[model samples]
Target: MEPSTGKKKTERNWGDKFLNIVEKTGNKLPHPATLFCIFAVAVLLLSAGLAALDVSAEHPDPDIDEKVKVVNLLSKEGIRDILTKAVDNFTGFAPLGVVLVAMLGVGVAERSGLISAFLKKIVMGAPDMLITAVVVFAGIMSSMASDAGYVVLVPLGAVIFLSKGRHPIAGLAAAFAGVSGGFSSNLIITMIDPMLGGFTQESAQMMDSAYTVTPAANLFFMMASTVLITVVGVLVTEKVVEPRLGSYTGSYKQDLDSLKPKENKSLKIALFALIAYVIVVALMTVPETAILRTDEGALLADHESPFIGAMIPLIALSFFIPGLAYGISVGDVKKDKTVVKYMEDTMSTMGGYIVLAFVAAQFVAYFEWSNIGFILAINGAEFLQAINLTGIPLILAFILVSGFINIFVGSASAKWAIMAPVFVPMLMNMGYSPEVAQLAYRIGDSTTNIISPLMPYFAIIVAFAQKYDKNIGIGTLISTMLPYSIAFMIAWMIMLSAWLLLGLPIGPEAPIYY
Candidate 1:
């Protein structure tokens, strides 16, 4: 018994030590927006040095005769271009407009009280045995509604667990695991699908002009990942995370009342509204003569199709309609002014992200304008090929690189914008599809989000945990979520390996090979 106790203490100490290091290191990092500013400065300096040294790479396309060279941002013309195009960079940024449009609808859904009520409806009825899994599953699904899960489900997970006499932090870990760690996995397409897919498509087009990555690029794999993450979240919560938490000794009390009658009616109304909205969208895309389709009536075959272009807006409306229905049913939307106020309030919360996006947009523009990214991708491909690290090994290496970068930069889009320019083209040159590359990046980005201190929601989650146990700190949150991060990484890696071995289609038209 003494030996066993000592072994347990040693093992526990090791985990605590590692998690403490991660928490301290991550906390030392600058805000993600500031990190992008630093990266932009680095890119500028690197561009100048590389340009002076005449660093260049042969264009991959045989049709393109020009060598891609690093353009020095320190040049007079480059300075003029930078000053002139800053606003254009922010406005023309791929994810910005689309995400804003998508979130507008999501904001309506969230502010209408529909998202909260809907999440509660799913979680409140979960059986004691399956409640952890249910909360985690709801968290994963809530990404479809954007950051509403952080606002609704994380705290709700604690309340539900407390109501069931389970450790609330364990429940919060399960929720955070799903909400942040499993963020990249979803049964339905969300803002990220198209957002990352756009980056992939842009990068692939640098090599192959015809490559088209759609919102459904990683749909099948992400759907599978949703199940994998849910199972992992449940197992890690029940097995590793919860046991470590021991018992709930916190005196915080929660009223375990079921969803209100009005909320239930709101859900039904929201469902009907959602159904109606889906039918309207399907009508536009399903018919042969549909204006949203291509000349041959294909919806997604032509990336230029109206349906393809309209998809994100349609997604926003899907949430907006249901939320408006729920809001009206529940009297949250009493007038046009009330609806507008809710939308404003929701968008107001996005000010920080918008600010982050400004810096990220400029960084991406600088990287693109300097052509340093293209040169790096070309050189990186050659280096990898020379070392014979081409296929699965390369994929794993890229995932690790992405995960390492993710520790400091938490926004998926911001990290991907930086990574994709280098990696997507590099992978394409290595004979892998950009879609596959994006999927690998997503795996790395998602798995590490739970443990990253820079994750915008990390502090928010720590606050949530502290509500139950005032002693909860950053390290406590990190230690609790560490299990989920590790479990997710291993399980997700296995799935990716199996996926490659099986040569499965990751999405509708997403091929694994270039």
Candidate 2:
């Protein structure tokens, strides 16, 4: 099924063989939930063995100046701790609550058909000159709304492309590339900034007690990346991915019905509600004495602000109120019971994720408690420090390592918690700032997300793809997305290299040097 791309058979065949091997090896693994369970067990055994070997690292943070040793899960105290915290682990998993809360509002928009209508209107009304770029841009911007892009934009990409007689998978690829692959890139500050920045700050404090890493440390770089990624996404989609995908012959076709009079009226109501909601939010967030503003007068800009904590619930309300307005206008919602039903339906779809989350949470928690990740990171840092690699080469090497690690461990904050304590101090000693190190790690983390099987959303993208072609598998999805990954890695690294070479500030008051 390989299209004649004018490449040599040897080159094409070699690529195909490698992808086949990857697919087969990945398929050989058990289900993701089961795999996480195995990972949890492996951490247990590894921790015990390493503990017996007397492996440990001196704590980086001065407050915890003692040696950090591995806690063997096989021990009596360890087992008891694990058993006691199992429920807490599952409940406290970061993504679980974020996803659930966001979906509650999104569920309303989706079920009320507001999201569908909005997406359809955007796609259908947009000129062909801007459709692909808009989709990619929209996906990139969705970071503010959390994972709503994945659920709403991804499938909509396919539907929009199909409506326009383009290959749907290509559209899916573009959206996935923008959403997951460009995760670290956005025009506005996102939850990721504070999430990873907290880890970076914790690590930096080990070396410099007074060091601080703000959430906006990488804002400038990330903002630039947003534009870079959108352009790259558009180019890859139009030039490479679409040509490779050829024409759409899929069984699934979008029902691109034009809006009826009542639906149009409903859409008008939704628009008015959305505009009014935005105005109210602006009023609350803009002024110095605004209710939603922090005591310092920043609204959702500071990590410690109540606005940050309130964003999820606010997101839910944003969608919910507008969706409710639209639904009521269209007669889709007669009473509160219908809204309750929509939320229930959304919650019901979360069963698989809940099981996966239970196991993943255990694995993450066990890994942290065991301290294997910490020890390895420390040892790795020591080795690199001994070799004394410096400058952009060092940054590039770190990005590559981070990317490789991302394939196995999917959570950004989890991996950073393990890695930052080691790399941050080590790099600071080498005269590079923690913000630079964190930015490098983020480049690595985001570039490979599209191709990594372990990413939390990877399976969902596969399922989304299968809606178009039932034969779509893990390998197929990976192969399809590999180009985006490769292109992003190359392009993003180049961009970062340029920034580093010029010694540009990564963000506001975020210098490259210590």
Q: What does the lDDT read for residue 267 in candidate 2?
A: 91
Q: Ten consecutive residues with minimal summed lDDT in candidate 1?
A: 1-10
lDDT of 1 by residue, 1-514 (tens): 1111111111255665576566555546566567678878998998899999999887755456888788999899989988999999989865566656767887888778787676577656567559988889988998764555665568768767876767777778888888875467898887567678887787778778887888898889989988999988899888777766676655675544578998888899999999988888878879999878888876655346677677667777888899999999998788999878877886776676578768878887887788865555455445545666778888987776667667755567766765676678878887888999999999888888877755656655765676676555566677778878888888988889889989999998888988
TM-score, one value per model: 0.68, 0.84
Q: Write the per-residue lDDT of candidate 2 for residues 76-116, one digit (tens) a residue.
A: 99999899999999899766786778778888998998876
Best by lDDT: 2
lDDT of 2: 0.80
